[model samples]
Target: MRELKILAVVVSLTLLTYYLVEPFAHSKMHPHVDAPNYNFPQADKVTDAENVEKAKVALEEAEKAGKEKAIKSAKTDLANAEKFEKDTNAFWASAKAAIADKGNVANGEVLVTSNCTACHSIESKGFPPVMDNASAAAAYGVVPPDLGTAGKLYTKDYLVGFIMNPARASKVTHKFVDGRVHPMPGFDWMQPQELADIVAYLESIAPKTMTDKEVFHNACQRCHSIKYGDMQKGTMQAFTPDANIKTYMGKVPPDLSQYIKSRGAKYIHEFVNDPQKHLEGTAMPRVGLTQASEKQVVGYLEKVGDSKKAQREELGPKFLIYLVIFAIFAWLWKSKQWREMH
Candidate 1:
């Protein structure tokens, strides 16, 4: 039918626009980034890459000119740099092997309690952070998550690198230049065994089974409150008051209630894994969540925002069929009228 032909053209164009044009536009807007690299192989990939070699050469030249101390320092620097690169590249695999071989859960607990509890909480032990969000924001410029699910929700390797170096783990080491200081500078100085021990402790505290909602709350609720996400309209709030978050962060973080629908899964995953990649200088810190945790967070976001996604998809084809059927009936009626005119 002529009507059907026009409708087909309209539908084809719509599908092409949605499936092809929109995706092409988005790809240009946000260039593709590989999945988060827990190993952080090139943690200082951007900033410290050239500097290390340059510094060593300069130090070597100084040593040649009769500065005995400079030669020794250059060798030390070169060795240290080489060791750090090797360790960082191999950190994830090494951490897993260490944890299995010699991870001491008890010693890890002691280490985390003494060193990590000041900023983080271990809900299983009922240890709240020593400092509240306002004070924490003043210190770190953003709120931090509780370590309640860090063990299970984060990959073992991510936990290791994150503990060893926060900025490196988050891919934001450049922001810490000129002694600017990250709120939580990781204990990179810790021995490999020591880092493994702390990870072992965190793994011990995680719940064996967690619902998607629990994953979201532990990972996200501290800094981002959901929109109308509470029992009442005004019930939900970030751990820190908006004023303190805004004073340093420059803007209130957007409500994530509808972001799953707006930003879509691909964008949300990349953004959450590394905020700096999406929004340069965004105050949102990479929380170092495991892929499973990221999936659960996205799942919960979908549940809250696009609860009808599955239903809509199921009904879409049926609705299109009904439209076509109606179009056919109208076309039939119009043909009968044309016969009368003839």
Candidate 2:
């Protein structure tokens, strides 16, 4: 009887924790995340981004009909729908045009050396970072990614915006407010064509196809290590630990293998879009990856971290039913035992 009572207490406490305490804690730590948006939501508003063409058509039709009032109204609607691309935000348009310019690879290489070799390195092309790893960590608080990988991982629009304004592109502008300097400075002065040439140079050196795991590492493993099971070398340590990196980051960046469970897809998406929103002063910069690259990275993380998630979800209900039935039987047994004692 005593043993049964003890079992009942343990079960009750476990049930309470599972049902109540766990949920409350989860609400706090949250999957503060958003659904994947394949279209780069932050791209500059294009003149025809929406169904503004419908309004334009209406305006043309009204002009032909000679309805002055209708034409005027249609014109207003058209204007409202289409926001012309302009400086700072016009990167998408300019990048598209420059890429269409078919990028002079030679010019791009020269531009990259002239403008970028100071802070970044293109190891694929033998451009070592101006400051060695330790010095860069001390100065920038994190080592910059190799531009070669960056070009492959980020889209034209994203790279242009990043070059123009690193803080804005990464969506960590919040952290840059009030005299705090962002590590990456803005190069808004560069012409869109110049930016294009640099990107073109990067693409020229990139392999046409890459594995998803390789994509994730190229995008993340410079700073974050996946100790959960690893996406690198089939071992849990995708990246080696370093004191310089730790001091730069205030700690070793958390292993990413299990963040899919803790942060959730939505949180990860939101985080990639903007890091300062969640962790105000984290050394991790907002990646500002376009929808495609972002999805790839998150998907890779899910693959590594949550392989058994579907299976666990499938079995959850059945296990819960078993626990409830067992609890009911236990309650009845306890009641009968007490009755006999009485």
TM-scores of all candidate predictions against the true structure:
0.77, 0.60
Candidate 2 residue-wise lDDT at 152: 68
Highest TM-score: give the candidate number: 1
**How does candidate 1 score on lDDT?**
0.75
Model 1 quality (TM-score): 0.77
Q: What lDDT tens digits, residue by residue, belong to model 1 across residues 1-342?
A: 787799899989999999999989988988776565443344335323444676678776977787788777887877766665555455444444543545699999889989988778776798987687788767766777788788988877667877766766665655677877667766767777888888888888889989998888787776677865544445346776677677645677777888998899988988887786678667676767777888899998888888889999999999999988998899889999999999
Per-residue accuracy of model 2 over 298-328 as CA lDDT, tens digit each: 8888889998878999999999999999989
> Which ranges of candidate 1 are over 4 A from the true structure?
1-20, 35-101, 231-235, 247-250
Output the lDDT of residue 218, model 2. 78
